[model samples]
Target: MNPELLIAFLASTAGAATPLVLAATGELVAERAGVLNLGLEGMMLVGAVMGFSVTLASGNGGLGLLAAMGAGALMALLFAFLVLTLQTNQVATGLALTLFGVGLSAFIGRGLVGQTVAPLRKLAFPVLSDLPFVGPLLFRFDAMVYASLLLTVAVGWMLARTRLGLLVRAVGESPHSAHAIGFHVIALRYGAVMFGGAMAGLAGAYMSMALTPMWVEGMTAGRGWIALALVVFATWKPRGVVLGSYLFGGVTVLQFHGQGFGLAVPSEFLSMLPYLATIAVLVYICRDPKTILLNKPLSLGQSFRAD
Candidate 1:
């Protein structure tokens, strides 16, 4: 491969992985607190539409990003209330949330279909951004790519070294015990779930505003499911989430360029590459029962009540 082409490929891979990093990192946090949110796809769709609509209307990418996160958080609050307060089944409520987000975003965005908004402008640092190959590969990405990486590091450090991380981990590992010790397990889980939603929303916004810069109904195209699988693939670790996301992102990017490499494969099979990689990783991971048993949050997917 030519050096310039290779640089572009790596850069595209980073961009492709950004949303997954954002979503999976958020999901990792929520799961660390023992909440399983399956409505990620819905939240992403809602966020995508909300962000695009807001940005198009306001002409501000920042506000659009904020709206996306807010929309996602609101959806998550609904999920949290159902599972935490009402004690509904976590899996069922999450699935319902996804369905609701799908329909709601479509309804809200009905008028905005086929509309185009400017992609989020990439940030530049004077001389840094002008450097030959390094500039385009690293300095040319938009704000969200850097934000995702920072978020991952912060989460990892918190989980491993901070008191708050200890408490969250405690809640996830044994909510009843944490509750007995006055940890307010329900409230903690609520916060975690909402955070996850906001991140999912951010991911969606990236898709609409940066990746393709257009709204199509269901633009998320199952990236939410891929993010979910990513958490499992990462064994719920923050760093692992980044690595796994990039791996999937590379697969996704590669598929798009597969024909260019003269591989003689059909476009359809190339398109399936990302999903196939996801399933293959999952199956490979599941083959080791100990990996799942040791890393999975003990109370994950279970409803908890203060009573």
Candidate 2:
């Protein structure tokens, strides 16, 4: 491949991975707190529509991003309330949340279909953005991309080094123990879940406002599920999440460019590449049960009652 083309491919891969990085990082935090909220698709969809609609009406991408995070966080709060307060089954409630988000987003976005808004502007550093190949590769992405990288590092540092990370890990590993020790397990989990939702929403907003700059029903196209898979693929580690997200992102970008590269494969098969790679990676990962058993939060997916 030509040097410039290779640079573009790398750049596109980074952009493609940004949403996954954001969503998966958030999900990792929630799961680390032992809350397995699986409604990421719903949250992302709602966020996408909300971001698009808000940006269109207000003509401000910043507000649109904030609205998207709020929307996602609200949806997550609903999930947290049901599972935490009501003691509902986490899996069932999460699935239901996804369904609700999908329908709700479709309804809210009904009028906004086919509408277009200016894509979020990429941040440019003075001399940095103008450098030959390095500039476009490193400095030309929108703000969210940089934010995703920073968020990943922040989450990793917190989980590994901070006292708060220890508490969250303690809650995830043994909520009863954490609660017995005077840590508010329920409250901690709630915060983690809401954070996850906000991140998922931000990812969705990026899809609408920056990635494609338009709204379409089901525009998230199952990236939410992919993000869910990403957590497992990363073995609940932030660094692993970043690596896995970028790998998947590369797959996603490759599928888009497969035909352009003159591969004789059908576009339909090419479209399946990212998902297919996900399944393949998961199956491979699952082959070693110890890898999962050792890394997964012990209290994950279990509802806790303070009684």
Candidate 3:
């Protein structure tokens, strides 16, 4: 590829990775808090539909993004009610939430199939976007890209460096212990889960309103499941999630552009590359948890009961 094409491709890769990075980071935090939400796909779909729908109606992409966040948090709250408050089966409840979000989004998006949204403004740093080729590749991006990067760093620091982070970790590792010490494990989990939901919503919204500039049924195209897989692929680490997302983005983009090189690959085979790559990564990532504690949050997918 030429310099300009390579630069453009790299830039697209970064933008494509942001949504996954943001959503996976949020999920990493929620799992770290000992909550397993399998409904991320559904939540993202709902966010995509609602975000675009609201933006089309209100003409404010920010408000639409906020609304998407609220919608995601609300769905997560429902999941919390089932698993946390009622002490239901976490896996089953999460799947239920996914089902609900899918159906709800399909219904809500019926009339929004062709609607349009005003995209969010791109954020440019002074001189940073004016640098050489690398500047165009890295500097000129929408605000969400920077926010996603900062979010990953902030989450990593929170999980590793702060007292509150300690409490959140405590809640995930051993909620009984956290509760015994007045950490309010239930509350912490809810907050984390809601954050995950909202972020997933924003990720989905980014696709419909920003990337594609319109809504479509199942527009997320399994990005949600990819995010879930990334958590395990990263061993529940924040920084790993970023690398994994970017890696996924690269493979995804390559599948589309790889044909131009005239490799001996079949078009049908190339079409399945993303899903195949996900499976390959998972197999390589967490084959054995004994050697790697990165599989997931220990308390994840469990019922937390307190006296």
Candidate 4:
């Protein structure tokens, strides 16, 4: 392949992976704290619409992202109240959250359906962005791309190195012990859930404001499900999430590349490639129960009561 084409492919792969990385990382954090937030799809949808609307109205990408985060957190708060406070079933509440987000986003974005906003521009590092080959491959992405990378690193470091990380993991592994040791399991889970929501929202905003810059019904197209699968694929590790996101991103981009190469297959099949790949990967990872039991948070999806 020509250098230019290779660079473009690499760039697109990073862009494609950014949202997944962001959303999966957030889910990783929550799961590590013993909270299973299945409302990621809903949160991403709400964030995408809200982010686009806010950016269009305010002409500020940053504020739009903030709005998206706020919207996501609010959605997460509802889930938290139900699952944590009311002690409702996490899986059911999460499914309901996704349904709510889909309908609510469609209603809110009805008028803004065809509208567009200026896509966020790439941030060129002074000398770095000008280098041969390396510049386009590394330094030529928008802020969110870089933010996702940093977020992954930060989460990994925190989980492996910090006291707070230890507490979060402890809560996920065994809330009773964490609580016995004076950690507030409920409150910590709340913070983790909210953080996950905020990240999912930002992932949605990235879709509207950066990736596509327009609103459409169900625009997330099950990326939220992919992100959930990624958390499992990564074995709940932050670094694994990054690798898995990029791997899936490559799978997504390969469809277009395949078409470019003059493949005879229908475009629809190409489109299904990513989802197909997701299922394959999940089956491969889950075929062995020991692999899952060793990595999965022990108390995930379980409600904890201080009493």
Candidate 5:
């Protein structure tokens, strides 16, 4: 590949990594608070359809994006209410949520299967976007790309350095202990879940309105599931999510682009790479009981009721 092509490929990889980065980081936060949300996939699909629907009506991508986030958060809040407040099984409730989102999005987006969207534009710094190879590599990216990277940093900093992050960590480690220390464990988990939902929604909007630039039924595919797996790959660390997401995105993009390089492979085979990679990573990460005991959220995928 030429320098220009290489630069473009890297840029595209970064762009493709954005949504995964956002989604993974958000999941990390929620899991850190001892709330495992498997509804991420469904939440993101709803966000994509709703984001596109709203953007079409109002002609405002930003507002549409905000609406998408809200939509995801609302679903997450519902899950929180069911699992946290009602003491339902987190895994079962989350799976049901995913099913509901998928059906609802399909129904509402049936009419929007073939529609265009004005994607969010990237802002390039003056003189920065014109620099040498670095320009194309870094400066030429959509707004969401920057937002994803920044969010990773912000969430990582919060988890590692801030008071709230410490509290969130404490909650994940032991809700009973946290409550003993007067921390509002359930509320903190709720907040974390909602934030995760918002991020997942933004990721969905990026799919419908940015990556594809059109509304498509089930456009998110299984990206949300991959994001869920990404939390494990990141060891539930916010910072590690950034690196892990890009690795997955790179593999995903490569699967399509590999054909361009004249690799003799079936398209279906390439399509399977994303999910396969996720399974492989999850197995590797969870293979060790000690590692999970040390790093995995102690109360992950568990229901907590304050007594």
Candidate 6:
């Protein structure tokens, strides 16, 4: 490919992967704390609508991103209350959250369906952005792209280096032991879940305000599900999540650009590339039982009653 085409492809790949990175990284944190939040899709939908509405009304992308986080955290708070406090089934409650988000976002977003907002402006380095090859590849993205990368690194450091990270890993590995040692298991899980929700929400906002800059019902499509699968594919590691997200992002962008490259495949088949690759990756990663057993949080999806 030409330098220009390569630059565009790389740029688009990062944009496509940004939301996944944010959502999966958040989910990774929660999972590490022994909580499984399956409502990612719902949280993202709510965030997308909330961000779009706020940005459109206030014309402030930053505020829109904040609103999206709040909306996502609110949804997550509900999930935490049910699963952690009320002892509801994690799977059922998460699925319900997704359903609720879909219905609620659609209800509120009906009026704003066809409206558009100015896409979030890119933050470019002066001379660096003007460089021939690596410039557009690295420097022309909006703030969220950079934020996602930073978030990933931060999460990795927190999980690997911090004392809090040790507690989180212990809680995930065996909450009973952590509890015996005086950690508040429920509180920690709640914090993780809320953080996950906030990140997922920011990701959704990135979709509406930056990626597409429009509102459509179910606009997240299956990206939320893909993000969930990405967590498993990454074996709950922060760096793995980033790599997996970017890989999927490349697949997603490639399908769109396939026609431009004179590929003979049908557009429909090309569109399935991302999802199909997701399934392939899941199967490949999961076929090894040891990988799942060794990496997955031991107390993941289990209800922990402090009594």
Prediction 3 global C-alpha lDDT: 0.86
Candidate 6 at residue 68, lDDT? 99
The runs of at least 3 residues in candidate 6 whose Cα sits more than 4 Å from the true structure, single-residue gaps closed, are none
lDDT by residue (188-289, candidate 2, tens digit) is 999999999999999999999999999999998989999999999999999898999899998888877776666799888878988999899889999999
lDDT of 4 by residue, 159-200 (tens): 989999999999999999999989999999999999999999
lDDT of each model, Cα atoms only? 0.93, 0.93, 0.86, 0.94, 0.87, 0.92
| Best by the TM-score measure | 6
- The clash numbers for all candidates, in the given order, read 0, 0, 1, 0, 0, 0
True-structure lDDT of candidate 4: 0.94
In Å, residue 215's CA in model 4 sits off its true spot by: 0.9
Which ten-residue region of model 2 has the weakest summed lDDT? Answer: 254-263
Of the candidates numbered 4 and 5, which has the greater TM-score value? 4
- What TM-score would you give candidate 1 relative to the actual structure? 0.98
- Model 6, range 1-307, lDDT digits (tens) per residue? 5667777888999999999999999999999998989999999999999999999999998899999999999999999999999999999999999999999999989999899999999998999999988788889899889989999999999999999898889889999989998998989899999999999999899999999999999999889899999999889999899999999999999888887777899989988998999999988877989977758999999999976
Clashing pairs in 6: none
The clash number for model 6 is 0
What does the lDDT come to for candidate 1? 0.93
Model 4 scores a TM of: 0.98
User: Lowest-scoring 10 consecutive residues by lDDT in candidate 6?
Assistant: 1-10
Off by over 4 Å in 5: none
TM-score of each: 0.98, 0.98, 0.95, 0.98, 0.96, 0.98
